[model samples]
Target chain A: MPSAASSQLLDADFPTRLREVAGMVETRLDALLPKPNGHQSVIFEAARYAALGGGKRLRPFLVVETARMLGGSLDEALSVGCALECLHVYSLVHDDLPCMDDDDLRRGKPTVHRAYGDAIAVLAGDALLTRSFGILGEVDLPADVKVKLVTELAMSGGMSGMIGGQVVDITVAEGERDEALITELQAMKTGALIDYAVRAGGYVAGASETELAALSAYARDMGLAFQIQDDILDVTGDAETVGKAVGKDADLGKATFVSILGLEGAQHRAKELGERAKNRLAPWDKAAQTLRDTVDFVLERKH
Target chain B: MPSAASSQLLDADFPTRLREVAGMVETRLDALLPKPNGHQSVIFEAARYAALGGGKRLRPFLVVETARMLGGSLDEALSVGCALECLHVYSLVHDDLPCMDDDDLRRGKPTVHRAYGDAIAVLAGDALLTRSFGILGEVDLPADVKVKLVTELAMSGGMSGMIGGQVVDITVAEGERDEALITELQAMKTGALIDYAVRAGGYVAGASETELAALSAYARDMGLAFQIQDDILDVTGDAETVGKAVGKDADLGKATFVSILGLEGAQHRAKELGERAKNRLAPWDKAAQTLRDTVDFVLERKH
Candidate 1:
């Protein structure tokens, strides 16, 4: 394994650190997405339009920071991080399709389907998802590491994970208020990728078993906390700030954390999850401060 | 690399051997597809419906046959073949969506979207595509081999391959009839995966550069021949035998090989391509008989 230089640290605010990583990730993503060419140029164009030019880059941040904390190569972390971002953006593009969530706006711009039409949106999403795996395959990592990352990433986003959650979400019967089902849906749909992002960082670092376990725990709690905050934001935040339709969950009568737990109860649960998430990284002490700060950011963010 | 026991061959007819391979692929696919479970059971069910008990298993047959001829492990070949099938099926499922091909029938049965609703169908397609990579990741091959397979498969099916072809097919501007453009589209959409299927078997066998080159040449010609035959069948074959809508290309006025070359010209081209494809395999002599026979099968197939 290539040794990662422990970069010098500054006591910068958490948002500043996040923005810095986001900027780096964006540059990498721009470089990574395929250039448009020939007859099939439109799909590449659509894929780039969807993947680039938007989003929090939260997953990429988690991947990079976790690898940094675990003393993993920054370059490898960025590749994996960019891959995760591609997968995330593809999901968003598909989710915004007419047959799915049918949303017009994504990241405050017309959704892929709206901008490129449904067929192109679907094809672009397909392209992005395939490119995600391709990115991992091409990353300068050990063969074994690459295999594990590909396997785990596919599992996280496939039938039993994100896709499965999406099926459940779309098929939820009206007036069914099962928090357990809703939680499972959220965990599978959203939490799985988030968890994988952190674990992927650990994998790249070749961290010890104990370190991996801690990261896994940190990711699980943090993922739930992130979702809860999203639900909270949907209720409280405006559409312009949120970048998409808000309160649509309520409008469609879909069950959410806020609906089942109540707004304050959901907020309390998220806080508890955030605290637990931070506590999981306690053993790493100062090295994990950035990750701990991330939990607070997940809870406190308005959009 | 593991040594493959060169299995004894029977002097069986070509159709019999093809059927034997297809049966084995179907059995393996049955075992590989994830079983239905819990809230996300629908996607799994739908994926199974689309993947199992249908199609010619042409790609899988190519993988297995090429590997067998090259003296590669049957088990590894089967796994790779199954993975290719999953990827192929996913593309078919997505292509049959209302906003795409809008075909209600596939393999003489209701399409995934027709049976499971559009949302479930979309999720099912996503799951299958992800599972295709996951299969490659978990295959008992050298990790480098797995990574290469993953990368190449993604490239064959992603923005520059099948998905790109589909976009061109859908977005074909009216009154535009460019044979070169159509050929490019067909090569990307259909030929890419077919080429990859044969090459994957060669990859598994650790074939020499010369052998790989020969396989590449054979696959390229065979792929075009197969596509040309498909166009001919679309015009002349009955829907019941074809197991899907026929005459649709003509109905849509799509620029197919038959449209551009005329039926006799298309037939002549396919025959010429098939002969060239067969000649590419001549160096292997008796060892490549089954694959050479596949060229004849491609040209003569009614469906």
Candidate 2:
């Protein structure tokens, strides 16, 4: 991990903060899920396994941190964070299905289908996706906020958002590979959920339209930087450290950022985009420091 | 087709009404989804194939009729109805995957995976599932109603609901078969969505708590009747009329109502449950007449 950007900000223990957010998110996820004691205990167990104990929790971190930055309650923000993470995990579970990405590992462990069966994994994913909507029905929050969050999640998480991108990805993998298509795919498949995460945080906090717009721009740029770097890492990184098979994208003949732009070009683009993302938050003061560094971290992440 | 219950009610135009609702649902679904124009158009095409053209739209029919009975606008009820139907289609698409039910046919046609391949089918299911939540963020309804609908959907459709039942169904298939287990499985898988359909209709229509309770009870009984009869049909119905593979449960060694209770016992139970379902609606007047027949129709349906 590049320590420079995160270490320099707000006397930041950047790793510590990520770990803290992940801890809180895991606890919330644990509470949010049903215990694995029902007649269909295996499904619940599989769902819990898919969601509960791993990953960086970066999306939830965005929701929690962004909400807190805009004067939202940690408790409520955490709820929304948990919901988004549930959805994120759901997508991962499905993506790893035998018919999809067909990965045997996720977040350094055997994927849900690998541990359980494909049938349970599919149901587990379905369960997680459903929870994303249900968890937002917080009576304490203004009803409009709840509706807005659900809409944001659905629009980004659904057809025109994540799934659409996934469709494009599958098609591209099967046929021709191009940078423009890859960009669109990354935007839809990955960026959409990231957009939802940040916007939801700001939405619940009642951020001004201007603030929301800025956040969107910042998130879009940061998302691009993250994906390009991810592609680059896939080409150059190690499987053990990356927690998945690396060089797999190239092996699959899928066009990626590193394919369209050479490794050096992609690295340059990521840094520039990270800078642009941080610059969008120039209006914010000290509270925005972590977000700025998050962009930087995205630019520099190895996995 | 058994025309007994449908022939007796609403000028004996019950079949016509059902057809009308199905048409309306198809039109609405067509409008809701994107045209297949993108580079990844095949997935969109497959999604449309799954959702746009067919099915009895039984779930939406319940939603529309129940809402109309409770004084909700047909148009708005249709919105919720479309969302529910979309989710139902999503479940069907995923369930038919090779790793799950592995059926090659559905709704008298090739399954989505058969027509569009597995990757597209997976993405199509995800798109539909996401849209179900996204569409509910309509500006027209009260925010509380939207939240309630999303929550209701999530609860019924999620782990504790439909997906949970599916998990149990898959697990039971791998193990021993039993009536008690089958009943529990049916409740979670099929009954939860059925419950959500009726309860959501009442919820959006501003039904009182007691009214919602009655609707829940009625839907529960109707759902059980529907599932029991479905199991019976699997034993006795023809594959051509039933659309997909029948005798699948028996071939898979899965416990079902027919397997547990025998054909006659299951049929008798379904009739009794249908009667009980109708009795719950006694508190309503003429408006609920269609719903009562719906219960009868559930008992009498051949496929």
Candidate 3:
């Protein structure tokens, strides 16, 4: 069933492409983040510090790769990628606050709150979140497309999505085992933003309704697979390799896929979801090869 | 020099009009905010608590009155006003957090952090802020106009604006008697959003570039006047009248307009700025009467 383009894409070096997109997004993030130099420079400095230098740039990779797959301009996709990265980084910064996760380390470095204190960390997270939307205003897309992107990001990041999931994560009773709640939480907290990144990539490309639907389904599966893999990693990953403390979720007794489903069961579900995600892209054929590879990478990633 | 329209506006029941707008914006905010009833309903409940039934609604008043004067649709303007109010409420929620201002009361009610705990309070603030932009997407404006509104709001609420000023406010050493720094802080913290409200009103109506410029200058003066008045009230007003603890600024040794300019000097400056603000609206004559009265209201408000 594979066409010439599919064969070419299959032969493509996906990890290399992912790294290249990551580099491009980091540069864009650097350019977009405000330079620190005034009385308020401390906030900007902390925002930059929190946003730059670390992580796999996985969300940005999704954005850029999906857009590129759909024939959108690389540069426009890069801008959106940076915006999503800022949002993801902001969530991390706030989650690390003393009253939140209280984590002191992220990516082998001191967290924003640890490095700059709680007030600046809070402001820096806020500034980055605001700047994410501001970056959309500067993208070279048409007005309607930009508006759609804003709405999508806002919805995904707001109460019904990431923040909703976070509230549940913090408020759920200890040792309470509810598979449905955990599933919904995973879908909302991490999955919503992942879904947004993919859909935004499609939006930037003016992808057809059919294409968008397929992208949505693909992302839904990928997001679940991603979360399960994350749970697996947390159970298996060491602090040095994972770039932050591991086993905290276990220590906190937070419900995760690996908790609800044993490690083998979680891995099985991830594999099944990854296959479904890749199959959803059958229409795109060769252009979807890299995305398919991404699913595999997510299922296999050690950190 | 006052036009007939100006005379009519001047004679208008300014307080009644302000209250009406506040009521309208509150209704819209209620409609826009996510409803509670799920596992994460606590966050929604907290967000609703933070956003509803408090404060003067002065910012919403500015947005509506300005848009109405320029012949924009009332419904559309109300949506924008609600969005601005949500952003405002988000700032208040975060500013009252333990690591921030450590306030126990807001508008005579328990602050969000006090009512919902620090974690939920942070999530509520984040949710409200995100919903603010989501509201903009539903407004009945042209796509480009909506894009402009998003940019305006994002910029006004971000590092170069409100958050920037907030960082400076907390980071500035106690008893730091820098007049210019205080002015910059006031402009960034409060002036930016106020300016956005005015200009967004203009954008909604497709106001001429010249009209927008006039609105900007008027809002700039009005914002400074508003802050000076706030500083004055903090010094002179009681907690019962102010609806929050008063004299906290003095207690904290923070250098406010009252501290830097002295009570009389600050009062004189606010009056001068109010007059200048009113003068900036000379082009609109009677149509701007409500706005002109707003300047007087800002200068005269006890709390």
Candidate 4:
């Protein structure tokens, strides 16, 4: 699909395709979650509220598209995709809590805590987190593969990964000039899960070791570029356009790629990394066209 | 070990044995967690504080003893035991948060939020929850078995289980009591994990379906007996002996077995359940002697 004829993602209505997949995930999630009724049903409502509306669904898209690229079953990939999205949303819900990021707005809507009181919001996130693993375990795949996927997802999001990264991000002193620490923080905070998205698809598709490694290289570079672009957007994008709080990083004087490397430098690095990421799929030829286009989109996305 | 020759549990120091296992789990948790030296080291410190230095280790002990009874490797069961404990402690940490039960102390120490601030405490629980899955994934076993274990753990502790039960416990209205709802609440809130502890051991040991069913029956009754005895203790025991607040259930006007059945009625019920639970293990006979003894201990213990 990456042939010159398909080089333009617009040919396939890229945003339209993303929206459809996002919609599909929303439906799947709705069906998978416990209905909001009975005692403490508010948590289910809150969990649905946190997961159902808004956001780009980028991680789920990666799982589905990558699995499709590797000739895996779309249905199976979608199941795992929903699990990934549940995890991502769980993180967002927790991050927006008053005790955490203290944000009231997310995706042009009130954050879970703001909408449903802090206590319910906390339970919503916890329920969502637990639900993700349960969903993964229920996927119709070979047991071993499912186990590996759960393990990968857990490691990527656990203490040494996404959650761990968040801890460091919020604790670091302002104006510290340690680029190494900054990179590690970003790698753990965001890169770990993004890398796992690609890896999860590869595992589901039974990709060989060499193929999986190649996928990892592409994902790693893409994740870095994605974060760089994110930092750029945080500095340059408006809250309305970004659909959430922005410039807070600057206001808080948090170290970012754009802060250490000048704006132009960060942009240049993002472009270089994006290209390298797309190039890693060259061995797979046109089969990885969607992924190649994805890297391009990541660097170019306004949000 | 519960034979006439081994009746000297106090002489052999049963509490001492419990403490030793608790100590071992603490060491393992210490090794499993991220070292608390980085920017957000407090989360790690708090997670350690929440998980270590507390509790009866009843869940972990169940895993170890059950697996040993089924001839599974002690090392494998202990690994799973620690994972279960991580999950249990995570619940306690979150439950004690200001948004939930709002308790100030647990296991005779300040709650995580009180000690490390609410945000760090929240993150600590999140980290520990994530860490539990990571640890389960890392266990040295067949991938399929590990997957089954993870799947079972998630199901038992997830929205449909412990978390779901906690949501109900906090949200249900005062009085207007029903025995069925009360039983459901206690089962989901406490029994689910205990059932899984036994089921986890059986899975590790690769027990036959008959054996697993037998284990499940024993766990189910034992859990009920344990909780009933607990309610009795809350009414009869003091803060100093209980090591945490007591009488809060009655204070909150919550409907418990003691409230519904009356104290004497509840005590008689616990004894009946304990006897039934012990009888279920007759097939394994002397092999399940320790578990039988545990049921007896649950009925008679002061705290």
Candidate 5:
């Protein structure tokens, strides 16, 4: 396995290619969600607002890289990546609604609710959520693969995964929560989507069983590490830097990894998890090298 | 075509058979959405609360009937019916949120938000919506059929249909809405799903172009009639009888068919539309006889 420092030494062309792929995905997403004409125009606009609102598009990147790693065409994974991002955006839109985290900011701008009012925001989230499946189901892929990918995406996003985590997080916020509960919540809420990103990419590429197993391991560890770092940043990062209002967890009385594990302990866990994630990718081809760098980037990013 | 009086003459065995089919569909839905063990338990429970909460199960019934109309098995259409119901339930859950209609009752019980709090309700809706596609995609149908069905469902549920109509409803409620605008909104919000119910059933049965076209015409007209009757009921029905709070549209200052067209005009329009819907299905076989009856039932029902 490449060392963390070595992983960062990616070819100069890598960032350019990644950006190009991201741009392509963005265009396709725009095409997939056309603005509705006539009476319900606002709903379509609200959906577009939530979807087009800026994010790093990291999930799509993972999808493209994982597909490439398994010797699959990026074209095959393009719509899948867009679908994943749509699901992610939908989750964020709902998460920031008045009933959930009740936040007003997202990605350095006012959230859907803040921008479009609560009713529109709720509908926007619903539209984006349903639209993801539409994109996936309409993609030109093999039937079995399409079924498998769609099933995996649903399981990851639904009660068994992301939604499940959100419920636990809400309960913890409303009452006293322990370290174990907090970790489990984080895994479901934040980690499930990331894990899905990696696995979905692999599935689209028709990765071997061994490769899939390895990728799953890598994703699980990376997802947890990413969440831990997020918790650490919530404590230490500024609102302007983090791109959302900071310290809401403390205000909400929510349990988090940093609150339970402590800053140093959380950092230690993240580093260990990142290393483990990297180790899992050791059996993959050179195309997976970018994914390894992504893990390191997850650990090192300040925001 | 079955006469209006003939349509009312429910086959002595049809209701019994429908109840049986509904039971089977319910069982399948339960099997498809099993509660995952551990931290995800709360999500599963909330999902069940919203999903299993009893309504007429009208959408699923339509799916089964339309499939049978096209010489397909109810067994084959079971999952499709279940998926449509899932989509319907998800919409209802979100629509009842405090930010939306702020409804406190649904199906003679507390709304999802009132019962499970807003966060869980939101997540529950998200989970159900995603799970619908998952169910459709994973069913043992041809890939092309799955794709078409999923596409139809998503389109009906997304910007051009349900969500769009909702946005228009909310917007027009803030001001005086014209008759044309109100009709457009109804066509999208209510008509879209109703249209999809028949279309998806035909899709699963491998419907021909002509049959699909005829069914679409039948569905479109019936859907409008259904919405018009719903508007009339909002003005005329009692809360206890309807199982939901009545006069919500006027209370929210939302324009409706009744509001824009007057009660007598709205009722006349419903009857006219119902007739048109029935006429469109005249070319179909005896199996479509039940569907024609359903269109009449939609307009004539008290609740």
Candidate 6:
């Protein structure tokens, strides 16, 4: 295991390094994709809206961290992180569209549909979704690892996981829901992609089966905790702070952990889950401590 | 080269075999994907609308045919075909969203957004798009080949190509049209993916560089011809037969080859391109004759 001082250096420099890596990845993403032309104009514009829009670089950070922990270069992990971000942004763009969540704002700005209209927003999401794998496939990685990573991403983001969770969330929003059902929904909708991000990063780093299993468990716990925090924040945080309309979840009668668990209970659960996430990383090198810290930071985040 | 009699056998039985392979491929797709559970109702329903809703199985048929041309098993190619179809369906779903094209119908049925609303539709498209690569990654093929196939698919579908073309198309739609600009758009929007399908199928079969180049050229010509024919069909074909609204190009004032070339000129160009596509395939074994025939069929089709 690396020394505590070295690990501290990783923690201190991680954000700057991550941002630099993200910037490079974004450049590569831009360089690789051809501008949309002809009848596909709206789709292209929408893709740009979704992908170029700003968000936290958490997934990419995981890709880099996991890769570094596994003795892989950051360059190898850059594409994976960028791809994950693309997938994340694509989901947000589509989720905020008129027909799905009907959200008009995200990340402190107009959502893709609000900025570019539904046609372009929809296409933007599609383009981003496809482009995520495109980035991954272009990266110089072992073919088997690449295949595994792509498969994991697809499954996590697809019908059985994220989409599945969204379906349940929407359906339950219109009708009745119980605690069990709501928990299951969050697990699928939010948990799946988060799980994929950590696992994918581990995959790029050549993590062993035990490490992947541990990382997956950590992600699953962290994801649920993160969503719970989000729900809590929706009630307690300012709209300006969170970058979208707050309390909208309550207005829509959306089922959430806070709604069912109550604020206090939700907070408690988040703390417990964060602790569990940290425990999962106990066997990993000290380099992974920041990931554990992120679990706590995510749960306690004000925005 | 194989005898003309072999070519005749391939043509006569190929579609039947292809259909059978499609059925098997569909089953594989069904098995690989998560079932539509109540939680993911939106994603599940939308996926069904886009994927199971009927479209000509043209891309999948091409995959099967190309695999056969290379003396590979159709069963082996079925997953690849299914992946391509998922990608095609994903694009269509997003393309028809209210944000993108504002399309209410597809294939004479309500589009995903119309049927399920926009949010679910968007997620559904995202799900399908991600799932396509997932299917490709998991297919029982060599890892190196899978990597190559994925790279090809991503490049064809991503920025700098399909997405990039879409951007140009949208920008150009807001400006005066030119022949060169229109051709560039067409190449990226349609030609890139079509080229990918042929090249990817060949790559999966371990095709030689010469074979890949020939197939790619053939597909490029066919793709342009196909788009031109589509433009012609938009003007001449009935909406009911075409399954989507016709004359949309005229209504939107979107620039197309037909709009620029005039109807007669577009037809002539399509015919000539179809012949060129067929000629490009001349070096292939007689088994490739069906692909050549399909190009001609695409150009001559009434709808």
Q: Considering every candidate listed, which one attains the maximal DockQ?
A: 3
Candidate 3: where are CA atoms >4 Å away?
A1-12, A235-254, B3-12, B238-240, B243-253
lDDT against the true structure, per candidate, is 0.87, 0.84, 0.87, 0.83, 0.82, 0.76
What DockQ does each listed candidate score?
Answer: 0.78, 0.73, 0.81, 0.67, 0.71, 0.54
lDDT tens digits, residues B86-118, model 3?
999999999999998899988778998988899
- Write model 1 residue lDDT over A223-260, tens digit each, in one string: 88898899899999998887667998899877889998
For residue B23, model 5's alpha carbon misses the true position, in angstroms, by: 3.3
Q: TM-score per model for chain B alone?
A: 0.92, 0.92, 0.93, 0.92, 0.92, 0.88
What docking grade does candidate 6 earn?
Answer: medium
lDDT of 2 at B113: 91
* Model 6 chain B lowest lDDT segment of ten: B1-10
Residue-level lDDT for B293 in candidate 4: 71
Each predicted model: what fraction of the native A–B Cα contacts (within 8 Å) does it retain?
0.88, 0.86, 0.79, 0.69, 0.82, 0.80
Worst 10 residues of 2 chain B by lDDT: B1-10
* Candidate 5 accuracy as lDDT: 0.82
Per-residue CA lDDT of model 2 for B156-237, tens digit only, reads 8887888888877666554565766777777888998888888888976889999999999988898989988888889899
Candidate by candidate, in order, the iRMS in Å equals 0.9, 1.2, 0.8, 1.5, 1.3, 2.7
For candidate 5 chain A, the 10 contiguous residues with the lowest summed lDDT are A6-15
Q: Could you arrange the candidates by DockQ from highest to lowest?
A: 3, 1, 2, 5, 4, 6
Candidate 6 residues A120-195, lDDT tens each? Answer: 6666676777778877787888889988988888888777877778777766654577778877888888888888
lDDT of 6 at A275: 74
- Best candidate (score: TM-score): 3
TM-score of each prediction? 0.93, 0.93, 0.95, 0.94, 0.91, 0.87
Worst 10 residues of 3 chain B by lDDT: B3-12
How does model 6 fare in lDDT? 0.76
Candidate 3: residue B95 lDDT (0-100) = 94
